[model samples]
Target: MKGRNSIQFRIITGLLLILLLSVGVSIYLTTANQKSNLLDASQRTLAVNNEMLNTTIRNIMLSGEAPIANRTMEDFRKITGFLEFELYRTDGSTAFNDYDTLNFVNDYQSMVMFDQTPRVEGRSIDTEDFQQVLMNKTPVISLNEDTREMEYYFPILNFAECRVCHGDDEFIRGVSHFRISLDSIYDQVRRAGVLMAVYFVSVGVILFTWILLLMHRTIIKPVLDIGETVNIAATGNLDIQVDLDRNDEVGELAGRVNHMISGLRERRDLELQNKVIETRLEENRKYLDHIKEGLLLLNSERRITGQYSVFLTKLFMREDIAGLSLADFIYPDAERFADERRDLDGFLEMLFTNKTADMDMIMSINPLNEAVLQLDQDNEIIIRADFLRIVENGEMENVMVIFENLTDIVHSRHELEEERQRRESELEQIATVLKMGPKVFEGFIEEGERAFGSLRGNLTNFSDKEFISEAFRSVHSVKGTARYLDFPGVEEHCHQLENLFAEVRDGSRKVDKSLEETVAGTLDSLDDELVLIRKLIDRFKEFSVGSESTQVSPFNVFGERINDMVKDISNELDKDVVFNLETDLESVPGLPEIQPSIFHLIRNALDHGLEDIYERLAAGKPSESQLSLRFIHEDNWLKIEVEDDGRGLDMPALEKKGVEMGLLKPGVHLPSQIVNVLFRPGFSSRDEATSISGRGVGLDAVKEDIKKMGGRINIRTSRGKGTTFVLLVPWKGDEEGVLV
Candidate 1:
């Protein structure tokens, strides 16, 4: 049963089917050709017999013997395979009907002997072959399948001898019709087909048997033997070998099988030796698991080898670290560590490909050294990786990486650095507080609270120019004081608030919920700073000689404060300025409330309105630019002015900047309208901002403070002369130099 289903059996079955098909096609073609030849011979013989009958019939008609012609046609019809033999006249009428032509001739002879008119009725025949022969004057042959016969109508031409009796009006005298049976020709074809079939069957049987025997001897027997040996070898018996002994393909296949069997024996011996080596390797793996450090191997492809120390799994907090590339295992976040990953891939390529390269020099630029990795969410560790060249037979092979965990040491160093920074901050704050004194510090804290409250209030409505300016100025005032007092934390917080307002002013940032939230958050931070300063002041109070009642008056040192500020600002701006101070309201009411305005106006005049030293000389003015501050009380209004002999307002530049800042339409504007824009929030002509005046908030804040006091300012300027701001404030004072 197995041999029947084998390859040899299938191959022989397919070939046998092909052979049978070829034999069937050959028999069909030969039989058809033979039938065709037999039909041609039969047709030719029938045609020759028709010609002989025509000659015989013609001679009988010329003899004027109807009996002879009728008797001759009867004899031809009685011949085997000749069904009908008759003569047709030119008008498709038969020359004789039932021996009627003989009778008619006798009657006509009698009439002629009696000297009377002779007439005889003839039989007419209607047939396609007869009509065709009469009209065309040619022979017509047709097959009648129903009768298994062929009909031939041969035209008897009107010869010269026949034409003597017939008229010269027609070319054909009559047609000779013959109907012959085709059954005999078909019988001969059937017999010949049977003989050919027998011959083909015999040849096919002999060839099939011979080919099958040859194939079975040469291919099937040897292949079956080889298959049996292979099955035995598959069952773990490698001693079996094929015994086919020849020089053909089968013999070559058997030899290959024998060679394969020998190789299997050698493989069996090698596998036995490998089992011992595997046992030793298992022992080495157990030793590696006990090692403290993380150790792994990387092949030339940069993929981690299967064998690695067990510490890697614990260090990475995962178990599937083996067989991963160095990039995937160490720097798993591809986008975040793209540079480092590229470096690692290049380093690995160089290390594996360049065998003669310096290992130490390459190791110096290793990207993985002191690398930080996040193992899982919320768990990160720092590792210092070191690579060792793993050499095999004086050639570079795998790389051995040793990872040292440095997470704890790094965290300890960070904590120490933060501690050092905190101490330095505390020392600086102490020095600033000691220089400014507790009273001024306390006042500043109180003032910061009020400024923050105002800023927060204005944050609700940025479109109100007064509110926006108020918010801006509050922050600027706090920043200026904080800087003078060397309170860096408070100063930085104010600076951040200034930036937020500046963005809103210039139309770069919108006045939305986000802006309000950011401003509120920054103000809250400032509040926290104030709380911290309060704590520091309370501590200082505990160690001071004077108590809280020993407060200094701001009016007594007002001039000194203004002079110091001007000196500092001019030196910083690299400008030469001659400052003049005139005041008749020393004991004025609310001096401290408007102190920030004065300071802002001074800073603005020096920073924004003044040019450098070279501009003063080129403008035909004294190199020492003039700046003046005045205060006068008259008619219940205190008048104050801050003047600068520097460049006045450039209206065209201001208008252009206003359009760019989205504060004005892009067209002509009045100079007064343009000047009013100076007090609008965040409208600065300066492209970049500095610590001084580019923030576009100082004038806004100054205007906001003056508005709160029901006061107004007036500006006067010329092209190259100077610009002056005169501030008018309401004063309601009573007798005895006291407030009402």
Candidate 2:
């Protein structure tokens, strides 16, 4: 903190100042060291030279003691400059002088042995250190005062050369003394300081410039380029790119940034396109589902080929329909109905050949009833397929599949055929009944003859009442028939007989024996004719009751129609259904036609035939209950089933429950017979329902009313298993299918 004497600042400041000060001091110290060394060296040289010269000069000046030696002294002096040499005798004199200032007095005293002074002109010394040599030999060293210039003391020492001259006084004689001026050497040391200053300033400037230039080239340029690219990117200009002209860390960073921007742009555009495509696809799907006809698409292998909505899914029932093997999802019988193998092969061939294609395919499907598998009765399944092939994205591809339901049209044809057959049969029966009517008249004539004969012959055990009773019965029959037909002759005959019987009861005697016989005979004759008429009438009534029914209840008409369906059909192919009739289960109070629907269902079961006995037996079922017609009252519904042990309906074949299929209306659950394809226009399960299915109009009509009544129909079977028809019909019908 403090300096002891001359320094003027605090230690911290002072030390820095001192360091600055030391810079020059270092230079001064170096100069001083050189100067001191030179001075000491030069002083020693001068002393030695001066001591020899002092003696030599003394000998030469003492006047020719030896000529040759005197000459040598002059030569030595010339070489030495004779600058500080002096000789002072014991008497005090300048023995030889090369200069006017040569000292023989106090000057010598000023030149100490190692100390040289310019003012000490010629000082000499004789000391105890050189005493012996000084006393015996030539002057080794002399001590004298330099009075001319200054008082100087000289100190001397012995030298070997001087000791040679004074053997006994070697110490003193060998000593020599001289003083040499050292001022000139000081000038050389000062000159060196100037050269060091030049090197320090010049080299420092050059080195500093070189280092800074290197820093700019290596570090600053890369930084500026990074800043420019960042600014461009901030403006959302992803196209701006940086080309760092090097394979270095910075170059890799630039590449990463460019890659990130490219990806973002690509993904954004892709997302937008995907959104639009998805929206349109959803709309198109809805439009397809809205159509009346069911539509489906299948791949080359007959598997469902694409994604569809839940509504579209109704076209096929199972979830695994799409992308599965055709056999896995479709009912087993469906494989045959659709002719799947042929269709699949054709489709694949068309695709591979790259040709446009279209075809109409007929498939057998039990669109309505599921229970009976008679193609003639409820199990008839027929479908029309329309197909097309097209190219997509430059690749041969299958186009859309559109399905149209043709069942109703086919069913209409069946009904027409049934009606024709029914009309013909009725006409035949009418002809037979009419012919029998005449036969009654001929029989009456013969009976009259017999009656008269009976009167003459005497009869026994006869009650008069019995005769009247017999007569009354015969007369009553004729009268009733005559009244019914409005027959004039027959009614008159009936009146006469009644009158005769009345008189007899009153006991009239005018009715004589011959007269009584004739009257009795006439009555008897009429009775015989009436008997014949009755026989004919009996046959006619039998025919009429079963035909052209006046009561068209849904069940009766449906039953009749179905009976026609199984005409000539077999017991093996179509066994009768033992109906589970629910007697207490009444139709809604207002709908009297429900019974007809129930009856038709049983008929449908029979026509379709129980599945084959073999199939039924294998399935652990009775081949006959065979057709099981059940009607159970449910919650507001009459859940009925008209099932058979026959094969199940092939749904894919009869895809559309059409008019030919006996569909009364849309969304209706018809009777089992109408629901089955067995009732198709020309379809007849003659082979299958050997006993029941012959006429084709079985289920086609029944299903119509059932559906209108708000019911559902389902068919189930394994190919070898029996078929079952399940109906869920409202207890109260919609009347749409009901007859007036």
Candidate 3:
């Protein structure tokens, strides 16, 4: 029963309930209305009959024809099928009775004496309607439940004619009572109710049957089919499709179920594929672990994932590296490598987002390649990293990072290179000594000794600009010759001495006792190396009378030496400098004798006058700074001009430095006075001393040497533009003939 209480059952039950209620209410109303209408009709009929009977009795009594009135009353009862009819007097005596009329009035003697004889005693009427009719002299009708009949009463009144038979004082003479049986009317009403009940029952049965069939087809059957399909689906039978070809809610539900099953089927296949991939990945991971090289797998986020090789843990010096961001381990200091981190982030972003594009170019310049890892404060390692993109399902998923430690390899290579260079240098030094014949070697040795002797003499008397200038010139001349002879050890020592003079000349280092000692020590070292070279030359003296020497112009040799010095300085400072010799070598006078002074000026210009490449670029100049040497003869004087497109002298800075050095007061100095400060013995503009400058000796030396040659040195400069140094010396004959 509970199972049967479904939508269909509920619908049917409700319909039946409504049908029954409607039919019952309708039947009740019908039966009630029928009874009321029948009662009304019965009362109206009795009223009319009573009125006619009263008129008849009144006329008959007036005419003294008692027998006719009695016979009429009798006929009314028999024709109308009334149960009883009686006329009673006011005193409750029955004046006329239909039963008596039938019994006596039918005979002639009873009819003739009906009005004259004593009134037959009426039944004493004590009913309320009967008493009302008598007292009020009006007609009354009522139903008798016990008899199943309706009784009617009419009060008789005394009129002028009725007074003849009765008394004139009486308002109502008598009462007429009539009773009618209700069996026939009740029978009609019962038949009508039965017919209506039959009609309603028939209609309800037909409607219920039609509705049951409609509900089954439209709602119940479809629901049952959906339920059964769902049950099958619940049991994992995804192949069972709900094929309800409807455009209703049920149809939509079926369509959703079908879609769900399709998704499930796809998911099952994908799960199986995932398992296969996982197995393959595990196998690959195991293989990778055995390899000696460090290997790590990183996701697109640069986070470490999956199993990593044991070597990787050893390389990074961390064991619990899995599931952490690779950036955290590699670039541990965010503040230190913030820019690199951003770059790496962008690199990974491109690798992940632009999966289909080739990443070879990006990987080639990757910062991690051949990066130096500072494992700790004391221990550092060089590593080469290689990246391989990992793609899955046609999309980039992860990156495989392979790290190779190159620290040992690099160190060994460096040591090997140093050893090879040492051996090569030694052999070249021996070969240079052998290549020169005894005469040329002797001349080279004699010139080197003269240059050293002059430099040592100047250093001993290094109190004034002339002595410093002579010392610088001697050292520079020796350095040039050694370089020309391919004597690297001798040349290197001379170069170091030249740098010391350069620093003193640039006012970047002070010429104190310590400076003198350093210069003396360097000169001693050079002397030792020179002696060793002379000994080597003597050892190889018998091997060859040197080949005929090619004659080169003295100016050409001087220019070449200057060129080499500038090149060397340029290389040391990592700057690009172009040196131009804009002079007629034939016209230059006293070239060999004044070579030291010219060389000093050239070295000074290279070390101080030219700006570094980066500074030149920032100043909107060419990356390679320019230096030009112009030699001209005018008015019996050889004017040598050394000009450079460099950051010119800062006069104010020089003045401030002069003030700080107690060379000048804190007041403005004339431009000439500021220029003269360059000739001040230890006045330097540079703050820190370098091997090249900040020793305050080069320009002072130049000035003194030019003065000794009976000439003058002057400088002209413009801020941020360039500087020019002009040496005006007396023109002498170029007695050393040009060999070119």
Candidate 4:
């Protein structure tokens, strides 16, 4: 739409259209004229050639050389344009039929010498053009559409010279028929027409280009300039004037527009001067009176000034707030905030009396920053107080205090924190159960229940060495299993039970009611954890039963788990990562079974392979790093690759850590061998452990998992480029060419 409507487009389009039409018509007319003239000239040449044939035949016939005449006509037929040439008799019979014309001429010569009758008969002609020529006694030139040739029949009349050898019985002696093909001549005409057309089109194109340039320079550019100037003025910037200096209508329009802008500028200046003061006063009044927060100014005496926000009175639930002492206004109870009032006094003194006091330090120690005031028995609010210093002549005279009500925000934050913890606990429980597997979790749950039952049964026998030893064994075993299964809550409970039993063994605590209750409480907590596990197991069984009929794919579950893990790791590490999972897990045999190992590799990439936001940008990479996991079927192996565009392996750090861990000798080593040290247990370069990655068990476990599957893993790394870990496992395709 814009293309069709733009001035340049319209001008070029309309002008080119007109030029094309004119040029097309002129070229067409000129080409037609050229073709007509070429056809006429070609026809005249053919006629002259026909005359030459006639003159040749006549000269030979007048010399009484019949053989030469026949030979001459044969030569004429050999010419390129002549398709057919022959002589015919007056009765529409063929004349000069091969050597028969020579025979007839010899007979006439014999009759002239020995008085024999002259032969005038020849083969009879069959064509209608021959008969028409015979009857009309005129030359007939006509086009033959089927043969695409021109037929010419020129009548050869009997003359007195020919009556010397024989008597004249007919007026016409014969007709010379010439069938000439016009293909070559018409082709020449077409070529001339094409050349003329090309000439006219080239001239038209040149004229069109010149006209377009002239229009753009003289008209389009000037109009565009005027439009730009008008648009600027329309935006309320009346100070600008159009600067088109010409003696045309466009120039006149620019002058008028500039005059209008000048008048508008003057009017705007007058209006602004008249209303500036009033507008300022109205804005200030609106701000102070209607602001949501409380505003107040305090003099050195710590008294609220007369100039205060209307909200201040409403915040205190009292009128007559002006000129009130700050202490009374803020802490009306007088006894509840006694210490706060003293701190406020010192804070005010620092702001208004002290000359060299750091304002930042003063604000940091603001006593009323989070002051909770009870307006009524049922109504309480939290307000945060912020202070601004008011200086006059470089001397502090007053301080402005802004009281923002943060009651709703603080309460909402607490609620959000509680919700966040609840959801996090739920998620952690789900992850622990899923990772433990249904059968392993069931075993752990049964073991935990029996351990807790034994501890409960022996709570009264805390002093007995035999019972104490049994209880210690039970608690230790349960704790070990819980820790292995990643149930921190149950593990911690068993640890507490272990501590209580240890105290009993050392005889430092008496086996009284307090001891029994504490031990019983730990047992109860462990029992509750087992109960939650049992419920999760039941839900798992139900889901398994439902999923069989539903036919759920395990690969989708793997993908979702991987997505969640990547998101969690990204948030924990505070890194920007784009995780691209470019694989159809269901299409790769045995891939789903090794998803846990794949998850370890993914987490390692996000945690150790990819760089943080600032580190990436500093290295001239994008702030968001790229991490891709691909599973490809190559040959008879499933090739899995996990890659990252990040700060690559720190070889020196890895070598140093390997030396400290005794995984490598303190000597120069290839980076490949140094990187291989990462697959060893307890080999970590991190000084501290994070929730995402630090224990170094991920890569070690991954290597073990691949080893169990009869697969191998390889690592490729560059200094500052990135790292890719490739895993290849043997796989024979499934029956339907898909993994089950």
For each candidate in the order shown, give its overall lDDT on alpha carbons.
0.78, 0.47, 0.73, 0.74
Residue 641, candidate 2: Cα error in Å is 50
**For model 1, the run of ten residues with the poorest summed lDDT:** 112-121
- Tell me the TM-score of each prediction against the true structure: 0.54, 0.22, 0.43, 0.35
By TM-score, the best candidate is 1
Q: 465-576, model 1: which lDDT tens digit per residue?
A: 6666667777798887676555667888888887876677657898889988998999898898889789988888788766434533444445555776688789989999
RMSD of each: 11.3, 36.2, 22.0, 29.8
Model 2: per-residue Cα lDDT over 196-224, one tens digit each: 55554455445445544553454345545
Off by over 4 Å in 1: 1-17, 36-81, 86-95, 98-148, 151-177, 191-195, 198-210, 231-270, 299-306, 323-367, 393-397, 416-740
In model 4, what lDDT does residue 692 have?
A: 46
How do these models rank on lDDT, best leading? 1, 4, 3, 2
lDDT of 3 by residue, 1-740 (tens): 24567777788888889989999999989888988898788788778877887887878857766656666767777964588777776666567534655355335445565543223334766678878886676677888757779888887778876675456987887788878788888888999999999998898889889988988898888888878888898898878888788898878987888888888878889999999989998898888778899888888677888668888878778787888876677777989988877877777776667666667877866777767778778878888878888878987778988889998998888889967875686577665444333444466667678877776776656556666666665555556455545566677787677677666655768878888789778879878876766776766655544443543445665566567767887798787989898875564566644555566566667777788878888889999889998988787888889898888898888887778877887887998877788787665676665555555655666666677888888788999999998888887765542211
lDDT of 2 at 630: 57
Model 3, residue 245: what's the lDDT?
89
**TM-score, candidate number 1:** 0.54
Worst 10 residues of 2 by lDDT: 144-153
Q: What's the C-alpha lDDT at position 306 in model 2? A: 57
- Clash totals for all candidate models: 0, 96, 15, 4
Residue 411 of candidate 3: its Cα lDDT?
84
